[model samples]
Target: MKRSGNPSARDTKEGLVGWVEAKRKPIGTRPLRIKNTSRRRRDMINRKSSLGVALAIYLAFCALPGIAAEPDVNSLPKERQQQWDKIKSGMEQEYNVCIEHCGGKSECEQKCRQAHESRLQREFLKLQTAEAVPAANDTDLVHWRKTSGTGEQE
Candidate 1:
């Protein structure tokens, strides 16, 4: 039977059957009943382990005064340094083109920098959405200078 005065309620036997079918789960697909007991004991053990690790690290640092508290970015692996150099090169090339277009004007340079940064970020956003990066053959100047088909982006 349908709920009283409910226009959207299932009324017919077919509708009732359909609702029941939708709600029903597959046979033999029972949920697991893990023995998730001793939670307090587990939490206490984890806290004790963490405190022990912290104490060990503190003692090690106390024993060695020359050791830095934080890792230095300059000490990154050679492979990582090469990757960073590549990224820096790409950005530097883009900025150089902007600088060229600016023609030594501070105001124009500022505007170009803003436009370059915006375009770079927009390209990154496109990549984040699984789109391919623009062709490597195209120079930053050529790519950046291309006019959009539409008067403006959405």
Candidate 2:
């Protein structure tokens, strides 16, 4: 048989040894794949940490004071506050009387409401006249009252 030029024998042996070594190593030994026990431990730790963070966030939101602030009525001007209080008291009294009357006879509720509205309108007109008059002097008060009366008639 005819023979070709002799190939290097040492190079062939080294290549075979490297291939064998590569095949012998376990595929699971790669960095991406954990051992069975280590994988279980990692999963447990992840679950616990996620639950802890969720609970912490929930508690932080609950502890905030968004719902605890009270409105400060005293911040309003004194005269305006007094006027609001008077109006509120009168409305409350009228509401109670209406409720009592309506409970006894529902048909009377409309008449009661009309009367209450007229009283409130009169009170508002008086307050407006008082505010319009510059001073307590008779001339100014008389003029304002006359003007207010004519305006209401129109």
Among the numbered candidates, top lDDT falls to 2
Alpha carbon lDDT of each predicted model:
0.58, 0.59
lDDT string for model 1 (62-128, tens) is 9665332222336555655565456546877989998997789999998877666665554444434
Task: Please provide TM-scores, in order, for all candidate models, with all chains considered together.
Answer: 0.27, 0.31
Residues forming the 10-long window of minimal summed lDDT in candidate 1? 145-154
lDDT by residue for model 2 (55-79), tens: 9999888865443332244755577
Clash numbers, per candidate: 0, 0
| Model 2: how far residue 102 lies from native, Å | 3.2
Total clashes, candidate 1? 0
* lDDT, model 1, position 105: 100
lDDT of 2 at 100: 88
